[model samples]
Target: MTATAEAHATRRRTYGAARLLLTLTALAALFATATPAAHAAEPVAQAAYLAARLRADPVYVTDQLPREIPHSTAPAFARLAKRTGVPTYVLVLPGPSGTGKGLLGAVHDRLGRDGLYVLIDASGVSDATAYGVHAPAADAATVALYELPYDAGPLRSFERFVDVVAQGSEKAAQRAASARERYGDEDPAALYLGPSDRDNQSFLTGVLLTAVPALILLLVPYVRRWRRRLPGAKPGRPGAKPGKPGSAKLDSGRKPESGKPESGKPGPGIRHRLGRGLVPAAALAGAAAIALTASLVFDQTRSSAAPPPTAADLTARVHRVTEGLKRDSVYVDPESARVLSAAQLSRLHDRIRAFARSDGGGPVYVLLVPQLTEDESAGQYDVFTATVHRKLGKDGLYVVADPLGGYIEVLNYGLRLDSVGLDLGLPESIGSGDDQAHEADDHALGDRLDALMTYLDKVPRSDEPNTAADYPATPEPVDSHVLRPLFSGDFRPGLLMGALTALFALALTAGVLGIVGKVLRRRNPAPLPTSTLPFTAPTDPSPSYLRRTAHTELSALAEDFRGSAGSGDSGDSGESGDSGESGESGESTHEQPPSGPSGLLPQVRAWDCFDAAMLLVDGDIDALDSPGPGPETLVAVVVLSRAGRAALRGEVNDLCCGVNPLHGPAVSRHHVRVSAEGRRRRLLPVCESCRNTAIVEPATVHTLLMTLPAPAGADGRVPYIETDGPLTAVPNGIPRLIDKVRETAGVQ
Candidate 1:
């Protein structure tokens, strides 16, 4: 099988096992609550009855006596009997009952008392009374001596009656009786005659019991919603200014700012948090107050009252049975004869006999008690079981029934001893037989007995020796019952409320922390600085110097050309002198130019140097050396000028292949050269194929050169250049000169 099928099967098995365990647990609780018949009073009565039987005492005192008779009182009784020459019988019963008189007569008949037989009914403080049997005939005075005193309490009156009888004081008894009569009747409402103390609850107590849990359930959701909204007061939209016609208004009729609260007033978030915090506090306080009030009212209203006469009778019967009192018949129903007809009783007896004769045979007895509550019937059943176990040597099945309560209990004793399978396996095989029998419509005592017999008949008769392994293993306890409420399929208002309350509480806590953090941060602002930039000098000054040198060379070249043109060549010797003078002046200018008036030489020289740098870096030195003016040449100049020579150098340096000035690579080490001729300078490439071409100035190159930075420094000092003669060599001389110019210009 696939994993999913196996998992599903495992889950199904787990659920089935869990369901079976819950059913068993519920059944166990039902049994425990319904059958509380194993009362402590039974054992005490058993010990007392055993003591009485062994001593052969005619005066039988049940264990239900309110207090033990003083040792002096017993001696007084003995002395009175000795002096009067008459035997007395005393019977102390728990409460008044119809059989009290009969019991007293039976004891008197058996003991043959001559003086008197006394029966004390101790049902309640106000109802206690004494009766004397077979006493001497007396006038009102003598009869009064046997009566209780009106002024005295129940215990005191009993003592007074005993004292008067012991002293034989008729006059004193008459006075006491007259005084009791003068005290009048006791209040009936002060007495307690119910089966349980639970009957004393007042109406107010009932109302509070229902109200507290309901209130808690209702408040939980309200609190949770309030807390959930406590984080921030969210506006309808962003950048929605306050006092606008369309904005939402605050409680004060003024529009609230987005993300801000009103001055000197808590925001909606704060108010919500405070309200949420108080909800649980109020609910808990209310619950505690109600609980305290109920407790106080219960304590003040409680009374010390005794159980009813019927409960006392039931208890006495149970004790009697516990003391080995067995009836001659199979059914014992004393309340009414119509409960079970003669034929039904006969049929029940036959069924019991048949069960004894069958496999795993054991005698069965049925005890039908008067109607009692389920709890009361269970107690009686326990006592009956003990009594039957004692008489039948712990080897019989006893069925006790309370027809009025419509309940029945089966007590199995020695079934396991006779046959393990019958004891261990029979109960499960019966399958809710006792419950079904009790719930039957007829609810007849005889019918319940028949049902029990039918259940017993189904018991397996296997006599084969069985080991512990033969039985199915006990199942592990499951927590499925704890989770049973969650799967009940009913709406749980309390659980929902509790969940909402928790969610809101968490939100409130987070919001409060956030607000506190903002306040703390505002109180301690960060420090500011005195200056924005750090003071530092340039690392390299070569480019600055080269720029100045290029300006000086261009200025002197321009100045010499202008001076030669304005003055005209005086002679060939004069022209040679001027040329020689200009060469000397150019060489001197290369070392350092003289400070003079502003001229265009510096600007033109800076532009020429910039153009040359761009061509070399762009790997387009051949175009600069071309004699013809073409579109390619024109495009390069326009691109360089628009982009600027520094920007052009950066762009070409990114695309070039060999090392060159302005940080680019070329196909040759000295791929491009600058040519200076009298008043003009041009760039040329040293390619072997382009050695014969005459260099032409492209308009784009000239325009591009105009955008280069002028060779001027902040200090106005011309850059010093080192050169031996005019720059005439096309390759080695021109490049060295340009390098010197760039170094002096500081064009990094």
Candidate 2:
């Protein structure tokens, strides 16, 4: 009981004189504290007094100094506390207070009360504590700050907390509850445009970033058109006269001195051409991007609020089950999301013991839990079960079932274990003892496990060795038919952050490309579409340019080997496309003696190829002084430079990719349908990456072969590789190809 309660008790039990004396003493103490001398009291004494003050009024204010929440506001709060029906106490302290838990606990201890106590500092609800009751309102105090607008004061949060703490505050509680839900999840991005996946957001951002520079370029001409129409826009220009006000207007109506529109302002014909040439691809990309965004947005809004658990969480959960499996044959996750009835659990336990006693090849261990997210396992339910078996190192038929989906995954690990080649309508995993798993809401998961055990008891394992045809072929993965995770929930923070960073990079790249494209267009005329050949790309690198690059590299390598003063290296080569061979070759690994041209020069290895490459790299352009270099000879230098640079590098293995030399060395040779000598099938060396792609892709991989000039055949580009090509010399070493290029180019 409080001091006030004790005083009331005394008034009822004690004599009139004693009661009167008690009241007078209390009054004297109250008046004494009200005096100016009370200001000198220390903070500890003030805290003591603050606790005492709570007995009289549920709200206690520390000082009489100026406060945003003045001392007068305490009485109104006191009334609010009185209306709560439960005992509520509020303590208001001065500033510089760290955490409120201590003060709240100290005051509650001093008061010796079991009630809702809230400590309010100058900052706001410093802390809230429930002495002897469950109070969610304690968490609400901090949540209110986030719920309120950033500019909202602490008083507003304090009010919301009190409003939710008391009974019969339905109106306040409803508002508070909604705000609490939205507290941490408020979308902070300016481009939020409501709820949507990060991919969609990135797509829109990329499109905008890409289009911005082009849009700016397009606007420049219109801006110039407007400026030219303006009177005296540019002083002393030929069109706009200084003296005449109508000079600009007169010039606008006049025919052009050269018949073309002004530099910035293109005519209708030019605009149409630009729209046809430039706008279609951009518009198509924008439409595709927008469609992708809309699809994700539609999917996200309909999904759940919880994020799918990560692989680590699932693995941890499996480890938790490993302990349970050791103790019992039937291990069910008690805290599983898919709740099991007592009867269902009892039945499942009996079934497990029965299966263990059966004549099956291995004893059965069963586990039941909720369904996992499809993101990890599309349809393969054996991952967790396999993990459990690996951890336990047991030999038997182990079963893990999703109590939510009634899906059973059976894993056989022991050497004595028999394979169950059963298949229901489902078609991804090896076995399907999970009868009604494909059909939603068919049977309880525990009941499903019981049914599977009963089926296994009827079909016991055999001791005889099984042949290859004993089990059917493994079914193809039907991931599309499986239930994938809902996109509506918040993904893991790491994934979200990674996706955002990637999208930002993509947007940056798109912006750079846009700027580069605009600059290129401004510098050169947009080439008209071609009729006989492919679309016009005026900046495409010619074979001559590649020849110069090859010479530059070969010359540098020659100088580097000859010079011991410095370790000068050539610039990195890249894979780019155009004219003869579409893409440039990847850089060769050429160190001085071990890997570079110097490495091959020691034993006089590939000397003929190297000599021929050197001859073409210099002799064709310098000695003959003919029209630069032949496409065949130029491409030959490219081929020889790679082999000559590094004799033992992986890139030089198997004579590189026969189809595309730029693909680097063929990791393995693939049998091809292409015809060779005497109508026999041919084998072509291909890079591992390209080889893997060839298996799934129906179409053929692009060849790096360049056709010869029209003189060989009318508009028939006879590929340099096809004409006096190295096809015959491919399987054999590069020496024959070197001699062949020398014979063809006639470079001696």
Top lDDT: which candidate number? 2
Q: Write the per-residue lDDT of candidate 2 for residues 472-506, one digit (tens) a residue.
A: 22222323222223332333443345455545655
In terms of lDDT, the poorest run of 10 residues in model 1 is: 246-255
TM-score of candidate 1 relative to the true fold: 0.26
After superposition on all CA atoms, what RMSD does each candidate show versus the true structure?
33.3, 31.2
lDDT of 2 at 279: 46
For candidate 2, give the lDDT.
0.47
**What TM-score would each prediction reach against the true structure?**
0.26, 0.30
User: Of the candidates shown, which would achieve the greatest TM-score relative to the real structure?
Assistant: 2
